[model samples]
Target: MSQLRTILICDDEEELAHELGEFFEGNGWKVDVCVTGMAAIEKLRKGLAPHVLITDLRISDFDGAQVVSVARELPPEMRPLMTIIITGHVMDTARAVDFMCDYLYVKPIDPDVLLANIGEFLAHRTFPAAGRS
Candidate 1:
């Protein structure tokens, strides 16, 4: 059997985080939710390598950009296959370009659409095994 796909969600909005976690979990993703960017970073430091990362851009502490930056700095084997930033603010092109992430989504996201996009992204990519040259 294939390994289960894992996802980490970091959003200061507790209700939104939990709701997203539940939706992804119900759809067969192993989901981890963090209500703070610090907690998300700590989890990464502790070696919680996930296939996907979804973080809110304007977290009260640390911010999503910092969280994504930390994740990007990890060893290749520890980096997430995809990093997505979600924000409530309407971002202009220049502002959106400031963050390092695979996708930048606006808040009030449609869970189904997000899931479909993720599925499409995964389908077109191959994940190499750790330590492979």
Candidate 2:
């Protein structure tokens, strides 16, 4: 098997974070879980660039928007290829667009859908847009 696809999942809820992390890891992806937006940003700044980032909108330290903002501020070569925000709070459609998040999933998310969405991201990365017309 090839090297695992790396992913970072940030959520203050320890159980949820670990659950999502384990699910991704079980599927052969390397997973890193952070309970705070600052921690997530610190990890990214320290050169832990994952292929994707899945973050909850509301956390103890800072909102997911901040995490997305920090991610975007990273040097282009260090940024994650895709970002997905999952939250139980009211959807902030504008923030999603402004932050350049590829997708936003509401809470009580369906694991199957999340998995399928992630698979699409990996495929998209593997096949660049140059392949398109």
Candidate 3:
């Protein structure tokens, strides 16, 4: 059987992370969840290349924007990684406009809307290996 691409979700909310992780896994999307921004960075350093990153704006260790900037510094081959930032703040939404970030999900994350918007962004970045970033 073909393995599903891995997805990394960085959020401090324990319950939401677990629920989303289960949902994604059930849908054939391999997932890894990190409760802190530091852990997320470490996961990446350990070579956990994910197809998508579902993060929160208010992570304990680092902000979503910082995470995005750091991830961009990775080698080209490690690039196609997508990011979706979920926050309860409107300021976070406005700041996200500066980046080529794929998606921004505000608080009260509606599952239906998230999946739909995320799908649209991920589709474009899902290029084959040889295409690299």
Candidate 4:
């Protein structure tokens, strides 16, 4: 059997985080949820390398950009294959370009659309061979 895909989701809205986690779990992904950016960072630092990361742009104790930045700093093998940022706030074009994410979705995000995008990203990405970064 194929290995299960993993995902980390960080959002200050506890309900949203839980709901997203459940949705992704139901779709066959192993999901981890955090209510703060720092918590998500801690998970990464602890070696919980996930295939994908979905974080809110504005979260408690820091922003999604910082979380993505931390994930990017991980070694190639530990880094997430895809990083996505979701926010309800309207951001300036120049400002939005600063986030280190593969995709940015404005909330309230349609979970189905996000899932489709994730599927497309994973399907198109070329992963490293086993034991390679």
Candidate 5:
């Protein structure tokens, strides 16, 4: 059988991260949850390439932009199919322009809406090979 699709969710809030992880898992996707941007970066650098990356803008250790930058620096084949930014703060143009993230969601996101978006992304993307990032 084919492997389940995977997602990486980075957020400083443990509850939110756990909630989102559980939500994704409930739908049959493999999920990795990180409570800090640095931790997420470490995972990515270690070559855990998930199909979708959903990160909070303001996170402990570093901001989401840095995490995205590191992910982009990986080999092209290892980059995530899409990057989703979820932030409670106002989005700055410079950071926004730099990342060119695929989706943006403000704070107080509805889990159902996020799940729908993930489903759409999964349907459209051709995922990369497993075990490389």
Candidate 6:
């Protein structure tokens, strides 16, 4: 099996971050979990270019959407950074799904479901993942 290029998870919830990190790692992805938007940005700036970024909408820290925006502004050679917004609030769901995220999943995200959809999410792209977990 091939390894995942890279995967970033930015969530304020500690347990969720760990669960996500473990999930991606089990699938051979290089995973990094950040609890804050600034930390996420710092990781990216330090060359942690992940193939996928899973973040939440509401947090005590900076907005997750802003984090996505910052990451998206990177050079094209550095982008196509597939994003997934996981929010509990239905109202914020629309914005996340419509623009910021390629896939916006509500709370209680099913780990297996997400894994199964990974390929379809990148079906239209040709970029290989950068690192393995």
Off by over 4 Å in 2: 92-95, 126-133
lDDT of each: 0.88, 0.81, 0.73, 0.87, 0.82, 0.76
TM-score of 2: 0.86
Give the C-alpha lDDT of model 4: 0.87
Tens digit per residue, CA lDDT, model 5, 49-115: 8888889888978888788888888877777877888888766553545556877787899989988
**Which candidate's TM-score is highest?**
1
For residues 6-121, write the lDDT of model 6, one tens digit per residue: 78898999789889899888888778888888898887776677888888877668777877887788765555358877777776427554646778777888989987787677
Candidate 3: regions farther than 4 A off: 1-3, 92-95, 129-133
Residue lDDT tens for model 4, 31-127? 9999999999999988888889999988979989999999999988888999999998876573435796899988899999999999898997666
Candidate 5 local lDDT, residue 92: 58
- Candidate 2 lDDT tens digits, 61-118: 9988788888888877677788988888775555567556888888888877898888
Give the distance in Å from residue 66's predicted Cα in candidate 3 to where it truly belongs.
1.2
The superposed Cα distance between candidate 6 and the true structure at residue 6, in angstroms, equals 1.0
lDDT-better candidate, 1 vs 5: 1
What TM-score would every model get versus the actual structure?
0.91, 0.86, 0.83, 0.90, 0.87, 0.85
Better of 4 and 6 by lDDT: 4
Model 6's TM-score against the true structure = 0.85
* Stretches of model 4 off by over 4 angstroms after superposition: 92-97, 127-133
- Sorting all predicted structures by TM-score, with the top scorer first, yields 1, 4, 5, 2, 6, 3
* Clash pairs (backbone) in predicted model 5: none
What ordering of candidates by lDDT runs from best to worst?
Answer: 1, 4, 5, 2, 6, 3
| Residue ranges of candidate 6 with Cα displaced over 4 Å | 1-3, 92-97, 128-133
